[model samples]
Target chain A: MKKNLSEDFSMEDSLEQIIQEKNLVYRPTRLMTGATLSYCPGCGHGTIHRLIMEVVEEMGIQAETIGVSPVGCAVLAYDFMDVDFTEAAHGRAPAVATGIKRLWPDKYVFTYQGDGDLAAIGTAETIHACNRGEQICIFFVNNGIYGMTGGQMAPTTLEGMVSSTTPYGRNVEQMGPPLKITELVAQLAGTYYVSRQSIHKAATVRKAKKAIRKAFEVQKEKKGMAFVEFVSNCNSGWKMTPNEANQWMEDHMFPFYPLGDIKVDGKLVKNVIQDL
Target chain B: MAKVRGAIVVDIERCKGCEVCVVNCPTDVIAMSKDVNSKGYHYAYMEHPDDCTGCTNCAIVCPDGAITVYRIKN
Candidate 1:
């Protein structure tokens, strides 16, 4: 007589299955299951989203994580990020996140905001939040132009950059120089860590993930404030395919912004790529 | 001994096919499949199963929890 061995077999199998899936869902796939993403083909939004989830899982804080969404393509962050999320006013993700953190100081708060939100309308809020030394992390995604708002020029748009607003290329005399957020934030004494990284290339993406992970660690330790600005590609706005955006960033933007850390722990940590 | 074929399968029905795993695979063993899955998004696939060294790079960077790797032991 055989005692149905199904129970014993399934128990081990299900556990192993969870282990197998762990590689994919490091923090237990928080992304809402739906049809394919609405993003255009080859956009950097997907890459940055993945990086955030991977970083969240690695830190084992998915349960304690809360995200503040912005009004750009990042507005959909609440859908992709499986954790609790709240949308912020046009460019006030930092301020919105500050409120959430104040209410629940033990939680990890992150704002997934775009260049428009981080560098323009939300600039004052972002700057003041940093000044206040809020124990939160900001994931500032700078793709140069505004993706969700129809390829308009953003404050982070490089000088002479062409966009819906600047069809003839942005002239420094008229538009002023591009906003370098990492450099600007590095000046703030409240910022405990500030790194400017990219997702255009393979090696650079790896570094960006590490920087994000470190930011999460800072949040876990309740470090004053941490900011990692990702120089991501806006393929939809740039009118180039995703691969082209990556190539463009590697060729053009790398020279202007370069790659590496601007500040950490009151001292400057160098970007290794810049040395080479 | 068998050639120890280890194929990387991405559960597209289960996959958001975000392309994170495709770019993160250290060995470059996986690439987006031309044929879209049931979800209508191109899922990652191992083209050269022979070249896969059982490293599971595809599994590691997958943000959607969709990849499954089989290591066939003789």
Candidate 2:
């Protein structure tokens, strides 16, 4: 067969070729609402949302999955994701997810939260739910700042990270150190799987998706709480271009919120074990 | 070695012109189109199709989920 009989095979032509040849490589997952996403350019929330939805679609749980959308940048996640979603007050997603999981034990229940909602306002709910082993999945998007609330410093904001409130960069002396919520939750015996992943690069995106899938699988097994943290970038809040923010995240965010599983099967992962 | 060919279809209107896909493409197969979409932002286009190795790096990094990649191995 002739590879390309046409000199100029435009994108449409290529798409048509793919349809005719049945060689589809990568297409948008069905779980996405297909509506234009509201996230700012280069925001990691969209990437994280797509990854989770991709996992949901692949696992064939679109109808059975219930997501708790917390107050923060991704509060409107339900508009983008096709799954059933319940809106929770600021930092209360885990508590809401706990209720849903308890009522519908067979359904896949997950909470999508941001650092401001998860690490700061929702810390108590997050810790308790995980500690109690709610049999739910928590997808935390830690962009280090309150992205939707005009770039306020979040609990996960790093030292020297500047925000509207911390105009001079976060001072460890005054503001205290950034909270390692993933590690804190991983310490609990009720947690079964805990991992921190990022979507800064293609390789990392693949890894993040895999982690999300694993977390969902753990939830399916009726295991304890499964938490996956996505150390993300807020380009608009950080006052940097999408590209620059990504570079900044790699330089600064990854060092503090290093990626990998902290715990698996109620024990510290090999990397964390070695660190100890 | 047989030449590896790839193609990417971008939803022009859905693209916010973040350039995440453009910068992340390993093979330089994509570029922002000179034409603007209805939203007045320049969308991405396959400026050079033959160079694409179908690595799917662009699709992976696109936050808007605007690009779809296809590959043909000869």
Top lDDT model: 2
* Residue lDDT tens for model 1, A102-196: 99999999998889988988889989998888999998888888888899988888777788999998888888888877677667778888888
- Indicate which candidate wins on TM-score: 2
Clashing pairs in 2: none
In model 1, pairs of residues that clash are A30-A82
Model 1 chain B is weakest, by summed lDDT over 10 consecutive residues, at: B1-10
After TM-score superposition, the amount by which residue A164's alpha carbon in candidate 2 deviates from its true location, in angstroms, is: 1.4
Off by over 4 Å in 2: A1-21, A270-276, B1-4
> What digit string (tens of lDDT, one per residue) describes model 2 on residues B1-74?
22336677898998988888878988887888889999898889888776877778998889989987777755
lDDT of each: 0.73, 0.87
Residue B34 shift from truth in candidate 2, angstroms:
2.4
Fraction of true inter-chain Cα contacts (below 8 Å) kept per model?
A: 0.01, 0.59
How does each model score on TM-score?
A: 0.80, 0.93
